[model samples]
Target chain A: MGSNNSLAVRCRSLVKSYGSGDAKVTALRGVDLDVREGELLMVVGPSGCGKTTLISIIGAILSQDSGECIVLGHDLQRMNETERATLRGGQIGFVFQMFNLLPSLSAVENVAIPLLINGTPQKMAESRAREAIEAVGLGSRPNVLPSELSGGQQQRVAIARALVHDPKLIVCDEPTSNLDHDTGVAVMDVLRGAGKKHDRALIVVTHDPRIFQFADRIAHMDDGKIIEVTNGASAL
Target chain B: MLRVAVKMLMGDRAKYAGLVFGIAFTSFLVTFAASYFTGFMTRGFALISENPTVDVWVMDPAVRSVEKTTNMAASALDRVRSIEGVRSAVPMALGTAEVRFANGQFQSFQVIGVDDATLAGVPPPKDGVVPAALRTPDSVIADPGGTSGKLQTPLRPADQWPGGGPRLDVPTRSLTVGDELLVNDHHVTVVGKSEALPRFPPRPLLYTTYSNASRILLPERRRMTFVLVSAAPGVAASDLAALIEARTGLRARTSDDFKADTVSWFLENSEDVGDIAAMLTLAMSVGFGVTGIMLYMFTTENLRQYAVFKAMGASSRMLLAMIFVQVALSALLGTGLGLGLCAIASQFAVEAEYPFRMMWFTPLVSSVMVVIVSVVAAAISARPVLTLDPAIVFTGR
Candidate 1:
């Protein structure tokens, strides 16, 4: 563990159930995890193994039947929807595997969305978006739309969007699953670079093994529970 | 984000064009149809109304409007002229006469006989020429199409006496632009052409001096058909109408009241106004329908992106704002184009002698309708977008 002890994301005794009695399907059972500030962590699991459910709960996009999820020092269950959304906007960023960029927006415009949503003036938001896009090595492609970019470039734009708001935590759901191996590595490099430069906690949830090398730590899960945890030294 | 939504709506050339086209077409139908209804109502009382220069219009207490009915009396004209606010009162008579065109065809015409000294109730041409008495009693001031044989005066079908062979005969004498016409064998001359006015059941029109019409239409009778009242400046027509109504027990109405009454009469008596209103309503409905469909498509197409925004920490308010902005922008553009088209179309209609005058509220009202429909459509489309799971983007669901 790093020396600094600021916890960016924490979950304790999280219990999530799908149904009751005979047809019950437990997605998360008695799980606990802590992600420290400035660390890049990868969550690996087989399909339907609850890695997604854990990330969802941490992002405040889903609710756990029973548990405590304190993300960026705010308890998810204690806040109302509006309060939670406000906290989410102020403290978190999200990147999707599909590079969910708005088709109507240009690369720079897509990156400016989070700032715009947070009520930043358009000029300032666009300026900040430009910086984020440049950080992802897309300095010259700011005006190109998602459709005009390759898979790798699209994901870079998604990364630029996630970092544009300067949030404390970045939760990425399969950020590189759709990309080819080389493009996926390039995207992960950009993500790790941003995480380290910004000193924010990054949690990437995916089943892709190719992305494991960019993470400082890895949590392995099976059957709704973490089976093993390893550091970057051992992951390599 | 508003800029983004706008760019998205305009990004696809075909879709944007289609959306604008649909909206403009819907707007055209709404304005055009409404204009027709409004124009028809205006035509019902256009004769007495087209002249705003006349300060007051007085009719018998029993007459709702100057066009629909008449009362026999020359006494009211002299009495009205003696009132304090009255600047002048002129005797004007509206009657139907048979005009024999040069082609030997005869047609019914609306003949307005006004006093030569004070053409108070006469409709002047665009150049504002008052109709004067012709040198001869047969001459008449006529509109271009007023000479056509197609002109037919509207009258109750049962009012015609079956035994009376076409009550009046065609003038045997040939007439020129300034020549006299033997109307009912009484010679009357053409003064000059008055401005063309549209009538509900269109007929050719003629304008002559008041004395000649008094003798021709009421050959055996002793008074004018109606006396028009003109109040002095600063006097209210309503007060005058009240004065005339109280004194004579004749149905006296202000000009506006008279016009409105005529409109109500036509709406009640004829199916034209009602049919036009129904068609205008249908057009408005179709406009709403088109906007709804276009907005629905726009929202549905952008749902996934909306979900992404939500996942990226955008609130429902922000998403809704984006939608409203997109729709408002589209509506403004469509309304602009539609108003332009309506203006062009109105020019053609007017040139063709089809009465169409666009009101000031048409564009404002139509734009409001479009925005309302857009909001409802956006709200419906937002439901699916609001429910989309952010996790699905990764899971392939």
Candidate 2:
């Protein structure tokens, strides 16, 4: 989503090629996009349209071979892997499509992980994690494991995990891809509510057009490049 | 933290099993090998370990231990008798011979010829050796040293001499108890079975008069191979040894010195024993190495999960401590079980007549080996963990 004078993400000629020279797949080809602080943006595309790859680059989980991706005033291309990891942990939270919760941990424990990683005391982290879990409407099931929760409940736990650390940006990759339409709607509502309530930038990558209604802006991708950027209401 | 570590390790029962089994196998190998070697060494001292009744062993100056055959003229006995602090020195003769039993079966045996005068070892019930009886012309007493003999009536005084002469007649055919048999095919023996020192060897040992054994077994008979000397109540062994050496110019060894020398001789000369010991040591080392590698792999596999905790912000030191504690606890379980098994096996070995002795040091040595193996295993396993990127939680690919 574009903000008039406030920028949270900046990219320039970002190029990411997989594999060595002879047998390579270019996931992102010199595409650039900007996300605004406190904005809820949905990146929509068909499969293999570089939506996930672009999000990965923005979140500092993957590197671009050339060009620049600046997030929170730090250049992802120049920072070492370790430095990127630190920045990601400190400022970014993630919600995966499959709800990647540690199977051994309870919902609250899963949520507390990022906080724990950030050196929060266990008791304090778990308490904050409980608040986030409750905020997602699963207050009573905080002790339940991800496997024990419904598809929507699991997604909420993932969202809680991402938000409990109070990160500046939330990167949700296909947050509703594994859920039914009703559960997907519920997950998007929780994600939007949490994003707006905390004033954190939320970037959701998805192929499902139904969830575009929850986005403040929509960015469409095709042939490994973003072809259109518009207000979500315009796309609807 | 320890509880978490324990739960995590126990949660994957199969992985912990692999680590435990490796350590258990190593413990068995190291413990068994040390015990076996120590048992073999102890076997050499079984017969005369206590040094009963006598303190010093007088041998040829060249004889370092009992394994070496020493010779001294019997005339040396007189000189020993004259030495101060020397209570008495009894002459003993040792030789090897082929004995043809009544069944016409032949077997080689070691013979210890003692002075008949002392009856020092006459058929049990009679303790001291008597010269008067041993010197009874051709009369011979057999105190079992070689083959176990049967008891029979003492021979007739007149028959003690052969053809009514001073020497007895040698029998050509295999004979029964009381029947005359030639010793060295020379002086005949009135075979008398004694309970003392039975199962000594296969050949028949005749305890006859020194004079008779001299005439029968030795060409010179002027020297005796050994003199079992018991010291006076107040005289120390070194004093007696010095006294005897000064008077007789012969070497004297204390019982412990003789036993040690004998063991050294055996270790040097017996290639089979040394080879077995060397092979066992090599096998034990290989066992330890294999266990170490296996443990490292198990820990390596589990280290992926450790990265999850690291991503959770657990310190590298904390994670290492967790792995080490897990390994140490598993090793404790495995080694405890191994030692228990060894103890049970040792008991069975004793009952089954296997010469097995497990000294306290055996387990100590095994524990040290286990610790070393575990440390090496942890080191290799820790490599994967130390290099783990906490970013994997995010990359999730």
Candidate 3:
């Protein structure tokens, strides 16, 4: 993909590290990547590679050490913490492998949090959260706590939370790694349906081959760098 | 967000309860301790506290407290009575005398002598109206020590060592209207037990007539320890005290000034109340530490949630406010539980006649402390969340 008016995320020669001196661990080393306005892209790699780190940098959750990185036409490298938080909150969504739904909140409330953080009125957020949850196919269990849900069901709730605020970009880090083979496929299908919108883009970092069919493009990472970009799972 | 914050706390049932219990224990300790110590301060002036009718107390110029008095000339009573604005003056002889108990033990007492004609400054006999004041030469009245027979009619556990000191538990048998005791080797009958001053290190108190007390005390000259005087109508006790002081050349203090003098004396001379002060200090330190630690652990455990909120665009101020709400709510809930316990305890303390008054200001002051605890606790827990990178949500770390 190329950086154009519709590009949701763009980066070139970005770098990042964990520590300093003898303890330093370089996580990202001069990587370039792009995703159009409406696309479902997956970045896959081995466990120690920088697949998660790259997605984290793209999501504005982590700052790169040095780079030109732009998401939704805004340069992340130049922004302060407060501005980055505002951008991430209003424009991005994140899904995790562990399905980090707060144990204290019910499924709908967990899904409603992003909207609440975005300053939507609570009643409106909850009503929208119900629709988002229903879209991901858990309408009957809106009030259930995360602990009560099965692995696949909880991931679906995580997906609902990511989609509820209608962000321009969604990032998933091993979103299906915890589920069984069949359950992972099911969750990937729901994520695929939600990610392929004209105004939004999706990026999933995964090792699971079962859900590779859902990605419009796949970026392979190795040793803190992107090694290949394939058009679809057929290039696997 | 604050509503969610509270619901979040309520959701963590086991931890929430633990946090509340910690705060409740702190609250109970501080509130009850303050009330208890403030009540104890009044015991320093228990003398005039018992005799509410006496407006002015005339004693020798050297007298500092009722417990530490010097004998004034008996003629000072006549002098005070003749002063302008003086309504009446009656001599009261207060002295410490040794009385032998049935246990073959002799205990010392602060003996009181009331005027035979006026019976002024004498607490009424508990069972009946005032009888002829010490008609018999060798008769003495005992004080039931503020319990007014509660100590006799089935003793309570708290009264066993009430006001706790060595040699204070000397009342082996309760006194009655006709029991005989020896005061200063002189045989005396217990004419009637009455309610007297509430004192610490509660010694046995004995009362007799002015003439008989003069004989028992054997002061070097004809003397009375004090002249209990009242102000005439439309006369301020303080105003009348100056006139009596000028006329009698003796120390004349209104009840309030005398009470203040006694308080000042006790504050300077007494080391016994230091235990209560120490307990108060311990309660406050523990309250601050325990409540702060519990809330800190609670916030540290929930640090990830705050980061997630931060990642989701909640400002540091907003998340900080949420944590503050949790701390404030827990403080109020716990303090209320502790105060309820204190209220129940106070009823029994009052009934048992232990000086445990719960002043209104204790709760007011404790609430302020709770506010401080809330801010400090929240600030402690807010540190991790404040500097949080929000990026932690993206990594297993």
Candidate 4:
């Protein structure tokens, strides 16, 4: 497969495993996937079904054992550690299930981290972070620590952090698994609205089914492989 | 990112204080031990330091230090004075004398006898008293160290008993001009007080003429302990000393060489040096242990946060830099605080006449030790963070 302008990520027959000898466990076995620009792609599976592994490779944080995994016109296998870190810092943003905001920092400071990582000036990064937080309805309390924020508010801060750097690709893992039903839906609304842009792709890996309607397309995984791909309500 | 690292470290106030306290304690103890050792070594050569004008000291070959001397025959002074580079030579007698206060209190003192003609080795008296004061018959200059302590007598005759006997409740005062004392049964009068450097083993000092010393101290055939010499205007002290040693078959050393020999003897024979070394080693080890363990605990507690940073595109180098900055700040702050505490304590030590002197290189040495401690701490703490897998951020707990 050749690179495609429309596709933000393209993977073919990717394989990854952990450990060695009798204790070895394969995490991804010849997995093929495509995430298109301007689309919200959700990989859903039961626990230990390689949803994290697939998104980790696409996020440029983990290397595949074999096969082709290209992210944003760059082949993952050919990039060195520094190049991969530059790719992740400059082009990709991540949101996690734990809403992993550095607890020592205020909400705005946490949101400004990705931009700071990308070498943006501190004043400009914080200004953009404040704007992103405002867009997510967290403008009133940008100076509070993460521990002081509610689960829903912290998730909104995580979304603001992902969008503040204006990265071309955003990877989210179990973004709503730690929130309640209504809060999870509200967080999804904020994430999908602010995160997905005309030239960007958002990949969310979730076991939570409550936010299924937010995905433009959902890929179901089982035993280290993508078993099926289906369009969600947004796509229809 | 540097701000973030600082905030993370300062966020936990208790751990930050603990780390700083460990380093500060180490610095204070190490500095204190080193300064005390330096003070003792300085005092080890107090007699040499007192006579700065003397270029060379000629003594018997068996004399290693001024504190442990072997006296020479009276002819040794003539032998040294006849050398080509010798400008002047004076006899110096060092001996212990038992002095009886007016109230009959007996105390031992180190008596130094200067030459009658030049008074070469006598420390200058306080209050502008001239060297000619030694010319008075049976007159000696009592050092402040002696007068302030062992030479104190009852202030008034009435304070003593009716028969001039000692009274336990009498108010006492240090001896001054016109005060008389009995030295080895000979009546001697204090004509002046000398400002003398403190000595190791802390003995009171009395300076008198060589004739008076011969009478006051135990009689011996060899009366001269050393021949103090001044080199000619164009002569180097070391060269003059070598020439004297070659011609006279006596040991001759420049003042500096004699001082070094004194310190070497102390280091080889004294337990004080060993004790100070052990204390210094203990302080450094404890500093390393406490700081290293505390830093490792701090890093271990924040491993997940580091993992989050790692997952958020932070390279291992960035994380390492953060740890280094944290440790550097702690080391600097702790060193400053420790030195400040030592400065305060040294004031009290001086007032109490304790051996304490902060040499120029002491702070520099302490800072280097603290840096080593901080580097080791940062390395120990960074190991876990550097090896952490960012993938752990995806896992729960």
Candidate 5:
């Protein structure tokens, strides 16, 4: 553990459920995890293992039935809709399983959405988004929409969008599931560079083991709970 | 954000174009209905519209419209002229009579009598010198052919007539300046033809000097239908009208009040007005239904994109603003297109001699309705967006 950096997320006894009564299914039972700034954490699990539910709660996109969950220093369940939305726009970034780039917008415009949502001026937002796209080495294809880009390129654009505003924490769900092994490694390399920054942390949830080498720590989850976490070097 | 909203809308060209079409059609219906009502209302007051120079019309108090007025004593015209603010008041007469044509067809005609000296209410002749020809004692002027034919035909079906009515063969030309016709068993000459404002049931028109009308019809004690008045310089017509009412003990109304009174009277007395109003109601309902349904469908189809926006940290307020922007742009473009259609239809109405009068308020009312359409549509479509959970973007469902 790096003792110098501050804690980015603090969780205790986090429990979330779906539906009710006979139809109820528990997605997260009781969980505790601490992610420090400047670390890349990977969560690996089988299907229906609640990895996405955990990150959704962390991203403030969902409300847990009961929890002592805090993200970016705010309790996920206590904040009102507006406050949580503000926190989501200004402090957190999210990447989902599929490359959910807005098909209507060009790559640069899609990348600029987070900054624009944060009330950044369009000109500056686009400039910063271009820089983020360039960081991913897809600078030449910024003007085409997601449909025109390859699967790997679209994920890069999604990553560019997530980091375009320099968010403090990024919660990524299945960042490389759709890519081939080589393309997945390439995308993870770009993501590793983006998340290894000194001031931000990334929590990526995926079943793809090829990217385990890029993480500083690997979290193993099963049956609605975290079963193990190990240093990446030790796991190798 | 607005740019994204626009881009998203453009992404679905079929829905986008469909929404615009729905809005434009609604706008056209609303605007055209208002204009159509305005056209018919003005037609009800066609007498005043055709004689715009008359500032006031003086008649008996029971007169609801100029066309349906009770005759007053000729002395009422003298009393009107004697009022202080009355610039000029001239006696006028109105009558309906039957004239025998050369084809043995006896067509009915609406006759208007103007002052012999001033021709105060006579429109310019369509075929011959009007006031000059009207000065001859036996002369009368008929309307141009279309109105003349319509008016000459009795409104009821021919089989319903007491005598099964007159047979119409080849339609005869309108009474030109040289035609002779027998009226009330006396021969009268058609000295001129004049263009008059058209009325429903198209009345055949005749214009003659007061003396000619007085001798042509059966003798009656009262010879005047209305005392047409003009305001003196710097005097408001209403002020002159009040003064004339006080002096003459006759009702005097400014042109605007008279026109409104005529329209209201038509509404009360005629079923045709009710039919027009029903049509207007139907038009608005159709517009409302179409716009609401189309906009709601658009929102439903784009629900996933909105969820994606919400997942990307777009607030509910932001999502609503985006929808409002889309609706506002649609309303503006649709209203413009609808008004353009109205303008084109107006041109066609003019060519067809349809009694249509377009005023500023017609378009103004339609634009207001369009705004209501946009807001109501937006409000309805916004509920789905507001309820959309941003988490749906991640569930991969």
Candidate 6:
């Protein structure tokens, strides 16, 4: 972890809920957390425990109903949709559980999306995307479509996509949930190796306890609130 | 992003093909219907089209179209000739007559009588035969359209027929020069064939001199149907037409105006026009319905990918543009394919002499309709995508 003064995310009593009236359900309940820069923070919980909701608010894709949730020093509540979108496109990145690579695009093209979103020229974006794919050990098959790649390879491409723009924060939701044990660890090795930069913070939401050793810090949750925060392999 | 959008659209080959097929089918049917309608309107004024030399036609005030005319008096020609813009005016007698073929079969024909002096309203003869050939005693010119079917006569005499009687199985041939027929019991000879334009409701036609026509048909008090006029130098055809109408109290119209009037009359009075219009409406409706549904389904199926894009920080405007680009591509490709098919079909239609004409505006109109379809499809498909919450990407929903 980085110095105590260098905080990448700071949340104080954050609350979030879904639906209205009788159908209403709270997903996050007054959660307080701090993530330092250059840290791999793994959020572990049972199903419907609000692990996804906490990260969603931190990722700037969802808003908290109350309290402060600051990501990279900008209060998400104070930002409008366009400003939040700009922040997400420029400073933050996402990795989905499904390895949501656009099935039609080649591996390199999928990795190029973030840079393209930031208005990078096509040639420059694609060249940088090829380097990113190469870092993820997919340089030889950059032109292969996601459908033609193995599950682990596809997830590596997804990781490459998340890191292509060199965003300050990367939020991954169940990044290895669909892979076998060996492939899951391999994908995590690639993700951790490529994602942990000096200026970047990675928050991974996962149900898998097998990869707990890979985290620098682990936050355990039950229901809608975090119960405990433990250091790295000590959580095991 | 545009490249990504295109790849996403064409990635689903089946849906893309379906979308194209739907649009293409609509374009083809709509274009074909409009072209057929145009061809019919053109043929409605076939007579006015054939007499390109005549600038105006003066007929009875009640005459609304060339196809249905009320005969004018003989003095109508002289009255039109005396008009200020008139250069020359001649009488034309038009009537339906029953003609008995040499095979003893009788068929109805639209007989046209041109002025004996100038043969003013006669179409040029085919096979290099001159208009003066009609000056032969009892001579008339046949239309090529008529000789092919309605004016055909048996190749041999009745004795050569099976069972010693006129047989349907016997070979029949088209009427050529020197063929004789009985018109109202008077003998007439086919002097030559004329390259006449095909009529709307096709009828066999014969062109004869006014004197010869008068001799063959039963005498009527008003034998002149129309007065064909030429505009004098420095005079416009429209000016001559208006002047003739004012002085003679007749319906005097420039050839182009007469064609427009004929088309307007058909539009107002013809059931065929209504039928074609209904078919065109049905085709457009089917196109809208099918293409819209297919596009919506395709968008819905790929919505997950869109959600991912949104999660990746693509704005609503960007997603909307992507959908429009997909639909526009489909519209362009489908419209091209449809029009190409129509063009090929039109060739066969022309060869078979079907009422089909693809004017310059036909394909343009079809393309415009396709654009409208594409826009509608895009708008409908974009609704859900624009409203989607990017947070769904985390929910695994």
The segments of candidate 6 whose C-alpha lies over 4 angstroms from its true place after superposition are: A3-5, B21-25, B144-148, B159-170, B212-221
What local lDDT does model 1 show for residue B80? 72
Q: Please report the interface RMSD of model 6 to 1 decimal.
A: 1.3
Give the lowest summed-lDDT range of ten residues in model 4 chain A.
Answer: A1-10
Local error of candidate 6 at A80, Å? Answer: 2.4
Ranking by DockQ: 6, 3, 5, 4, 1, 2
lDDT per residue (tens digit) for residues B1-397 in model 1: 7777788788877888888887788777777777877777777777756656565566665566545766566777777776677667787778887864432345677777777676655555424444554425455676542234353222332322224445333333322344434466565555555556577666667776777666666464534666677777877888876876676655656677777888878877677667777777877887879878987897887777777777677787777878878777777788778878998999999887786867788767766776677778878877777666654554533
- Compose the digit string of candidate 6's lDDT tens values, residues B324-351: 8888888898888989899999999988
DockQ category of candidate 3: medium
- Show the colliding residue pairs in model 6: none
Q: Candidate 4, which segments miss by more than 4 Å at Cα?
A: A1-5, A22-25, A222-236, B62-64, B97-108, B124-140, B144-195, B219-221, B245-249, B295-300
* Tens digit per residue, CA lDDT, model 2, B1-397: 4445675666566777877777787787788777866666565543234236557777777766454475787777777777777777777665655543332334454455665557443443243433345556555655433233332222444333234333223233323345554456653545444434333112344566555666666475344766767788899987788777877888776667666776686678768567867898898889888778877776676655665555444566767887788888878987887787788778887665455779888899898888888888887788788787543543324
Candidate 3's residue-wise lDDT over A8-52, tens digit each? 889999898998999998888889998887788889888868887
lDDT of 5 by residue, B192-253 (tens): 76677777546777788888888887678887998889988999999988888887789999
Please give the distance, in angstroms, between residue A222's alpha carbon in candidate 5 and its true position after superposition: 5.3
Docking quality of model 1: it rates as acceptable
Native interface contacts retained, candidate 4: 0.57
C-alpha lDDT of residue B290 in model 1: 81
Which residue pairs clash within candidate 5? Answer: none
Candidate 1 wrongly placed segments (more than 4 Å): A1-6, A13-31, A120-124, A196-199, A215-236, B50-53, B70-84, B96-106, B116-135, B144-194, B208-225, B232-234, B267-269, B368-397
Clashes of each: 16, 13, 0, 0, 0, 0
Candidate 3: residue B136 lDDT (0-100):
70
Question: Model 3: clashing residue pairs?
Answer: none
Q: What is the TM-score of chain B in candidate 4?
A: 0.88
